[model samples]
Target: MLCVRKSYALPTIILICLTYFLFANLPPGAESPSVNERTESPDTPDQANDGRLHFTKKSEKYPVSEYIPLPTAAPSPIPQIQYDFPPESWWGRRQRVKRQKAVKEAFTHAWNGYRKHAWMHDELSPLSGDTRETFAGWAATLVDSLDSLVIMGLMDEFEEALKAIEHIDFSTTHATQINIFETNIRYLGGFLGAYDLTNGTYPILLKKATEVADFVYASFDTRNRMPQSRWEWTRSAEGLGIEPSRNTILAELGSLNLEFTRMTQLTKDPKYFDAIQRIADEMEDAQKKTRVPGLWPLFVNAQDMSFPDPRFSVGGMADSAYEYLPKEHMLLGAQTKQYRKMYDAAMDPIKKRLLFRAMTRDGKEVYFPGNIQATLSPGRETLEPQVEHLKCFLGGTVGIGAKVFDRPDELSIARKLTDGCIWGYDIMPTGIMPEIMYISPCKHLESCPWEEKKWYKDVRDRLAKGAQLEDLTGMAKSLIQKHGLPPGVTQIADAQYKLRPEAIESVFIMYRITGDQELQDAAWRMFRNIEKMTRTEFAHAAIDDVRDPHTEQLDYMESFWLAETLKYFYLIFSEPDLVSLDEYVLNTEAHPFRRPTAA
Candidate 1:
């Protein structure tokens, strides 16, 4: 049976305020259209306006113009030297084919487990053989894995999944509320990605994608048109008023551009694109006003479009928001320039402020991106040395941004960052990167020698400040004797491995961009380690700790384990031209969206 949580009831006072805000803020000529009336725009030519006012009067303030099919400008051609692949003979084409098949087999094992144990649920608990609904009980794993199946040529599985998708009613869900960001990327993005890959041969894919997108689009029906990042569809369905959350994270509100724009492209309804574009406009205005000039804060107030928190990171709370900039530019075939402008603005500070080199025991010069806690005073921001496995995706985002925008220097940084994530995997006991850890950063970007005494002292100081004496002693002993942690790793903040795809995601991008055979070899080692450590009788499971080879297996398996992690692993070994970076731009979820043709 599917899990159903009780809905959150809105406070009466807040509801009254929202009602007045909606009516009072209506533009002079704009009728405050009901949510149902605002759901669809009239069908019209690509460039022609539908002769409707879709937004509040404040919509005129949007920095980006409305949807119009502009003639795509030819992108600057990539230099041939940028792509230096190992010749087919050098890598042995037969061996590559075998590896690709192995990855497919791994995917199939996981998929079959989901089918047998948790078919219509969000995830499979591989160990205990239970079903879990992390998202709405909508077969998230099935929908999320759709494109992966198509990419791997699992036509039989794809057809089976499509049969199930045909019956999914997006209008209602067991869960009272859904994460707007996760739903958009996994379900909506999944449908569109599969549609593109199959060249619309399956109209059901687009039909389903449109259905999911419409459900998502309704969340943007606020006075300001900014979406409630976590939307309560049940309340909206109940005819209770809904408003955007006063507190929301950057990625939640900002990462919808790629998926929403693609929806508009396919349906010729500007409503989807218009909703996200309004977000972009507000973000553009907010970018320069942030404590860090180029970057936006992690937490935002969607109600008034304010940045309440001054913390910034290229990591969790703020990752995909920045990631989508260059991707959105490529998806539009370089027709949109604001995305490029935003990309440049953010990358400048990210290179200087967030990215740092780690001083390793072997004196290897590798870079990792970190976080910043900003103060109102200039030049007083605190740099947090903690890094998340999720941040590893930055390596790929940067590499692709470099290629798309013709920034060669950033590509070099991309290589070092990719290597850093690989080092993270190689250093751990299970040969898989942990969810999060703290590192001793080097003062210099290019070179930093390992100083044993300094590293020990820094670790001791950090432990002494917050830890109990016995706790500090135990941690010190464990760091030296039990954990056998690599130098420069101050602490394993989160030891669990969640079967994340970010590290491999970067490796795949590096291979595609540079044709680096070394990356392929590194990825193979990662896959072997992951398979050995996490494989269960049923399917793969996330482990308790990456530092223990015999760690207990956790019950839950994320959808990305198959949708992204294995998909990237398979593509790394498959033919280079398959899902070519030049042809398609992948969403944060690793679903590949076909790019518009460059003129």
Candidate 2:
């Protein structure tokens, strides 16, 4: 398998955002209008307006135009949830481990080029001077290293990386949005994962994670909070007048909240718990303010609260964080319960409407939602923009449907959605999954930057490959019909193979929940495929760029996704698993720094 080289593997790292199907320009001949597809543009942000007058007009003095500014209010306290690791908690143990070691190799390999104070890269490491990807590259490497520390019970190694996380600061001008890398995927998981592994001894990770989370916290037009998106800095506190992406808050506060929630429990610190709850409340506020329950716009502006584009809404890209909903756990306390209610409420539609369940209009069992434009206002759109949040919520609703009031077919519907996503052929040529795919068709490639003409050419030169689309598709469908979607996720469209892994680990969970052999077989195949692609260091799946493919060590380090994929897989295959991962993983915006507080 090809690795992230000395450079890649940090995935969707450095520069991460969304423009779903921007390249495909719509799939081939699948142009039937969707439920919410408007004749006006269905791809960008303005489509939400459709000229209808807003239900409740804003104050005459603060009339809303393109964006709606936020009203200042005192910060509220966090809520409480409770839990204990149940027997079934670690269901996907097998899947998580198989994938973990493979991905760990990728990170270890990437670190070969690790420098002291400067960033490094593969293709462009020598071109001009410093590349933003360089910083993103190193941050991802260090982030992965930190993960090893947590899971391997080596807090000492984690602390070394922690120092870099704390002391190292990038020049905002040269890198622009590149440092946004740390907050992308692995960092959040590693930090919070530290606490989970240490049996709550790693409070520093959570506390420090919060401090670092402030980097991209506000995202609107704020002087600094707004991100350097599309090379454009959100100049004012108004945030380009857009609602922040769901991932944005989730990565920062959401991920941090997970850590703080744990810290609160470990140290019994009300402040940590308070912080997590406050973020959850804000997420709720953001959700209610958005369009339809399922729609998750990519970015929003603050000046007039106008939305930009939800299509690859940077933070809310894939459904990686879908599995973190409230569940019974040994460590989670009242925080789990409170989180469950809000998360359950927010995720309900996703399970029912978005997950690729048998009930889907297209019956293949995949349930990736097309972003909609029903937001009441712009700011709201940015805050809670995840198409699958509904499906995730549904999974939770079904997992405990007895209490949540769901339908009898909840499991059936959820299974189909998950299956369809995994079976969708258009998802990826890698036979794995890309970040995002189209429900319909967007045949043009220029619309998307990453998948543009340049990217495909890069893929063409890959050294090794395995597995065909039919194999994965067949297995996904079979698994779903036999068992069902897991309790916490929606479908991962295999039709296009885009956003493929979003549904990977959860499928293993489904099998664990029901103790079904068919699901295990499906998981076994996924593991085989990943291992088959393993190169000297990491799995081929770990490398995004084929031109520079060569499984490196760093790629494998924080391979949290792999960790999750295999861990879950392992648990399903292994008998009598421990239920919860001693190490909890938060696939969020991984920040090296702690949350902000006055010095």
Candidate 3:
């Protein structure tokens, strides 16, 4: 789950008075510790050891001096074939029908569990048959799962959730500072998606969505127009003019355009569009000044709008910024070249700086995406190449961006990265990739990949002696020793899988684009593994570690497990005509938004 800073539970009047007192005395350009700065909590030992189950995981700052620079040799691109709409005839209509039904059944089981044990709560802890309130007491899982319910043709459940939406009072304020980005994507996006799915028949959904958006809009009252990462709705904005502290998260600002911009079209209110447009422009402008094009530092100063350093990764804090680029262009009907231009500019740097091909112990070469901790020095030496499973979402994002922008090179890069992610799953004991891994970017090592390398043990011995290993704490030493690695060259930095859907989300998009049967099969295998491992008496619970899949269950069921993972699984198996990608673009939360008509 995404970590958020929370305000102490205080009476509404006292909280409002405190806010007024704090911000009232601040001078122009004087920084106050805003929610954005406080929002980033250091990784707890558990998070560092076993990664969280969400894409919005913790962001860590690595020193600039600890990286291997990118190889001067050109990256070998994966070949791409022209994608035909109807992929293949191997899976007959009957098989597809069966697969879809099975997905629905699984969803039904999970949903029924939620209703039975943890109805009207943020999420279900299937292990304890209890509910947890992470967000406002608004039944987040049900709301997030709205469009998926309709897509699966679960009319009874859809209606049940619909009635619940009618009674949801978004006007309520709480001690927990609502994370505007998450609330917008999962809840507001969910509402808008369900409304569109139902042909806008449910105006109450729209009304509730607007209420939430309106309540959060106060956070954008800053002079720089960046929204504070979190806000207490209890405090009135009448006298408070405190902007985000010196630092604001890129993902929080960059990911807002789709949801809020769509709201503008729906309600015909420019406030929503105007608020995000300025930030979008800032993102585009920041690219021009960045050392690596299309990549922005994780944090930027809210007052000066200056990015502090050159640390870049398509995970956690920076994940959604790149995701929104092509999406923004598509959502705006490709009329605006700005988003496409930003996306294009970013890809060259991304591929050059972040792509790596590593050979495992068995002499099989695998390509993977890695983060670049860049430096601004004239001869910048530090360029760490590491991978987070969350970054795997780039596979699908890049694929979609390639298709929309007609960039074959981008598609090729996507193919390589997606294959790498699948490789992670293929080699895992439970057939699920861990949250984070590090790939060996050891290029042209003298003793590695010699012509005499015939056995797995030989490669393993060479790598163990030659390549710098990633698992400094020996978490994956046993696997490394046993597997004798390069083609399967991966160190599980964080072994937990918090029911994340990025890899599967990529599989869905890949199948849709390439009509690759293997991708579909991969999705099926993943779904089955997830179902088998996560099953509890009431509902599925997230596991503490994917390595020990069934040993222990984390007492939490994140909303996204229902919203994105199963939804993508269902869509991949269902008929292509069910939810046409051409007709809609799914937000980060898997909520489908109708594409806007060409302006």
Candidate 4:
């Protein structure tokens, strides 16, 4: 039994009108079809005389053009969404500035606490003023917070963090199996981000990024090009026993493109690119073999790349895999057709197979992607029809990719999915969404329909007396088959809210893309709830249960709470132009990397 590197983990944000302006100007790829290539060519001469006049004989003053300009035409005529809010009076602007400052203060408060008690550790236990190590004492929180500190202009904290980063000895190797996904996003992603932000002001950031990436790259030396989710740095490839039939999770295999690709771009090392790209290649192979068209099952055999679990989700095990599809394309300036094609392929199936539009108990229509169960028989799959707060990331991911790819249909999906997520928050008693939610299939209780839905409700009614979501599984073909819609979120299992960032992350994107004031207000409400519940004398801690705002604290403060959650909250309320999404593509973890200026 090898020790896995103990680490606290992880998570995405926003759009801007100017982002469209910049992205629209990017050099087109070879396969780039004009936006209107699918539409009428509009090359008719004398439109009224040519019998092209089906609509009111064409305007006399404003005749239809013989040729419509290309979709990439300069200065888009399409209207952009503007942020709706009170007038920017001096006082209003002053309060907005204060809000930004308050977020900075929250960051500083967490930073100071971490510095005093957990300076070289992964995260802080705010309740007890103690430190904990994750990723083998890598100071993950400090490194992850570097760019945020830089962004917020905490020069002194940035200097201190840099000093700590400089002294980090990546030469120390460990036999503990580290989580490749967590290490890459929080550590490698953080360093690359800080490095790019400062224009290479501190090469130590790159040095550390390369070091960690090199160490992790060892895990990819697999026969099937699927890296183990866990790795031991000391022995690198040789340490972890090579089980020919070992299964690897999809998220780990699919989420590394941005960091690895960025490394290649910065260092001109094709090996770094090749190491991760092989996984992408393997993904292309796996999709063809999997029963699901675009969605891959959660578990795939590392040796043959065959899916095992028959279950697919945009949740814990598989969330970031699908998340990176469009992002990889955007990261590389949509020049990588593999990424774009993969993304396009995944979106439709995800909507058709995994997604469901369920009516809440309160009669609101909520569209969510349920976990899919693939059977031996194709097209006979079942759905769990529940939503995880973690999966809230899908909305923003969809929204940003839609914006980049010029897919208005996908943007509509993004909006509906985001609205569904907001409904999750609204239904929670404490005004903060729970870690898991069951979107009751009951459009009407009088119908008492759907075997899964009925069983779920019965199980919950019984559970009110005392039962577990995991325990109620004795009646079906197998315990797994016994599973159904989760009894309407029976007891909000895993009730604790560990300062997760997904909901706010999507809100940030929604506000930027649609300029929807309601999302902004929702974000504010969530922030105030978290702040009110989690704030402590030293620093903030994760609350035990979002269901009960008064529930005891969890003592733990995940680094992402600082890196992503609060950062997004601050940005959602800030000026949209601060860092336009057009010029930067965000990694799955919400670390923004500069998009290519050229094709």
Candidate 5:
């Protein structure tokens, strides 16, 4: 359904080669007519988000000059004392009978502890980690756990917690931006699960889920295509200056609308389907203006999607939505005509012609997967090659980065690419991922047997060492996105840290989705690695110095990666189609839409 305008086919491979030849001689990271100088957004230390700060979305040259306030919610109702869990039959009587009680306990404990505080009391504490109703700042992730919980007959507890989540609001900081996205996305997840459980009908819980979406939509304006990554953490949600790039927020919103529309088809609500149309329109505008005939760059912050600026290098977010559309729609109804038309037009030539097969020194396409799936850690940005360009191509064909399997003609092709990167770049076997991998770095990849191999090896190794090396989930994303990824590349990957829980998580997703015996082998390998690398002593998830003596950093607890790792691991062994049919991101602040009508 998605139409790629310019594919390399068998002919353009020639043009790509010609382009490669012309630029191949240039030094890596050499400036091209295509790669523009980066302009930084002006920093206004004093301006803030609560209607007290104001900044334009596109201009990076100046600081915010004004401020606006956010709307204040009336005091929310008393938090519910209790909630319901799905019954034994929901998850199959056999498993439900065994785990229902445990789920009830977990949900109840989480609910009671979560419900005690008021949003009035340090609701802004998400940045500081306040106890009153926060789900580790990544609540949408819990939506998956919630589904499992419901099946295990613990929906009651979720309903109670859901009530609490509906009431809390994040109006400031990057976390606020993320939370805003999550609430909307999660509400959709919850709505879908409820529909499935209730036999294609909306229940009371569905309405509650819609309420969450409605509140988020009301808080953010869909008309304003460009969204700020951060707003002030004050009562009046004003002076929202645009962040570095708005595509991540915007794409997340657009993708969510697609989900809602498909939900509408099932539930017969025109509203859900129509909800994302405007965002889609915005995306169209963005494509026309920014079309590089290759990939969209990172500097798009326009209120008008019709005009995506091409001067900047694209980042990770946009790529995520583009490549994810096909399969995700099958799960969320992404196959619909309206959504398919929208995405196809946006993908353009990059899907076909511009996609590369190896790394080159210049920013020209050479392949090697552009960047390794290195994790971004707190504060640090960029690997050695990226240097000042700290951001890795998080998701690359568009900005966030896209996974590749174009030459599916050979299963060995993907591995060949991986080998080029891993062996050549001296990539860490320990699991840290970079946000981007440019065509060219510097002297290295000496280990690679061939030119391509050498290039990839150098790229991955430099990135792993320089990168925080924690977000290995990219590997899983790549596996499913690329399709038919071997177990070794997907699961048995390198990490920045000798001991990486994130790597385990990647293995989990890979194994769950593929159901390949190789993936199972990878999972077993991951299980053993985790056992050897981490220790459970003194009631904490601490690092194992004896085995994973890579870093001496002692203040280690199971990071969010660990939770995700466990989630995937349990899923691979427990559920087969865990993430195959869903989009990984959700954004609420980008749009104000009615909830999904599908049950």
Candidate 6:
């Protein structure tokens, strides 16, 4: 009797559950409304056709109101300089178009070679068709070349590159250590520039950029929040202790603001900006305390954030630090005045102490920024008459700074510095500047003559350290004949041409700022010479010596060859409005970050 009652009850319960479940999730309009419900009118607001409730009306008790805007002053207007750009008759529209096409073809040739041989590597060994993992095997050339592809209207190649970018896991790399400065400028700058240029159409780039920023941000984990310029990521990941170096290179430490600030602008995360701003504040406070009152040394004591080294240069160890000051001011929309103040303070001393005229055989009026050796006394500082191809970037830096800051004197100085670099390329047998060289200095900046007696004296002083007249004379003659060296050029310190972009970088800036057609012609000649010398079956390779026209090709090609060098070359031929200086600020790597409009 109990079993019979249980079975009957179970069947009754099952039938009741089925009936309830069937009615609960019926399709809309399948079931009729309850008797108490009223039909919704078409005019009814906040009513969902799916029968879900929504609160659309504002609450009477807690009314929302407009918020006050943040206070900000409008940025000063950029002075309109009437540039003397070559007219169509002078530049010739057909010739301009033809040059542009040639540049595009060159880029395509190199890019295709990279794709075929070193698609996922840091660099392509153009000579051997091999790949090198110079930067964590991160496909550096691909990321670095993103904006260039967009600028050149190479959408097909850009899309193909995107497929590789999407899979890059920046958090983990084969590289045991990474250069924070290089990573920031090349990868972070490249990502943000591509993102801004595309107007947020590609969110993946920003995602990748954030990943890279986060990865490098770990290097800033210190008591002072100063980053480790050369970060050992493998050790850091393994929970080993890592800290900022006691001695840090100025350019490596200070060149990070531009890229990190841009990251903050796009992501709205202040951590990236704060990390770099702390370094900037440290630099600003220490600016006047250095051995040279206004200039900082090549290396700084990171513990105290002081300039302990007496060597000062606008070259390798210190180039981009000063370059970023005015650019950061521009990037921040000139709202921050410290960068402007820092730039002005630094430039005054740079112009007065570092710049010197080179006594050319042709007596061309040109100037180069030389390194300084600070002494105990301020006036006793000595100048080293060595110029670096890297320092050629100063020409463009000052040119744009002059226009932005409204300094006409600096503009003239900028032209002379640019001409100095062009002279370097022009005099070289391969028509490419050497990595570093020594030159004869002019006593006067404004006026210089080819002092034949002074030239011989310098040669004798340099070569007569321990050698006899025969060896010295033979060495001097060899320097003049074998290298086909120009007058004023004393020695080729590093004769290898590493496919550097600084010379053309300045030329592009000067062209944009002054609209000088002569700069365009100069850049065209430079491009032709570089293409003829460096071009390989796979891609362009660095040469063993610029003094030898048939110089042997080095296996490695730097990522900057495509990123900065070729991009600058391509933009020099492109229309001015494509990446106008007024509309964008470029990082040291030639990645263009769009400037904010004045409030």
- Find the 10 residues in a row with the least total lDDT in model 5: 387-396
- lDDT string for model 5 (399-430, tens) is 21122212223223322332233222223233
- Residue-wise lDDT of candidate 3 within 163-220, one digit each (tens)? 8878765655333456778888889999988887787988987887887777677667
For model 6, what is the C-alpha lDDT against the true structure? Answer: 0.80
Q: What are the clashing pairs of model 6?
A: none
lDDT (tens digit, per residue) of candidate 4 on 434-453:
77755545433234334564
Per-residue accuracy of model 1 over 266-379 as CA lDDT, tens digit each: 888877877888899899988888889889888888878988687889889789998899888887777667888999999989988888998899987789998888886766
Q: Per-candidate RMSD vs. true structure? A: 7.7, 16.5, 10.9, 18.9, 18.4, 16.9
State the lDDT at 128 in candidate 6: 91
Tens digit of per-residue lDDT, candidate 6, span 1-599: 01222445788776565334222332211222233222222122233464322223221221113322211466656554335455566547777778889888888898999999989888889989989988877889999999999999999998888889987868676555678899999999999888888888989999999989988887776556777677755434533334566678889999998888888778777778878888888999999989887788988777567688989999998999999988988888887678889999999889889999999888899999998889888857878888899999999999878988888878989999999999999998888899998888999997888886566555655545455666555656654665455678877778999999999999999988888889999999999999999999998988888888888988888989888998999888877788888778899999999877874
**Cα lDDT listed for each candidate:** 0.81, 0.36, 0.70, 0.68, 0.34, 0.80
Maximum-TM-score candidate: 1
TM-score of each: 0.87, 0.49, 0.81, 0.78, 0.49, 0.85
Off by over 4 Å in 3: 1-84, 87-91, 237-239, 361-365, 442-487
RMSD of 2: 16.5
What is the alpha-carbon lDDT for the whole of candidate 5? 0.34
Residue-pair clash count for candidate 6: 0
Candidate 2 C-alpha lDDT tens digits along 345-398: 555544333332122223233444444433446334322212332232233223
Candidate 1 lDDT: 0.81
TM-score for predicted model 6 compared with the true structure? 0.85
For model 5, the stretches where C-alpha displacement exceeds 4 angstroms are: 1-144, 148-179, 186-204, 219-254, 262-269, 288-291, 306-315, 331-335, 338-368, 371-448, 451-515, 527-564, 575-599
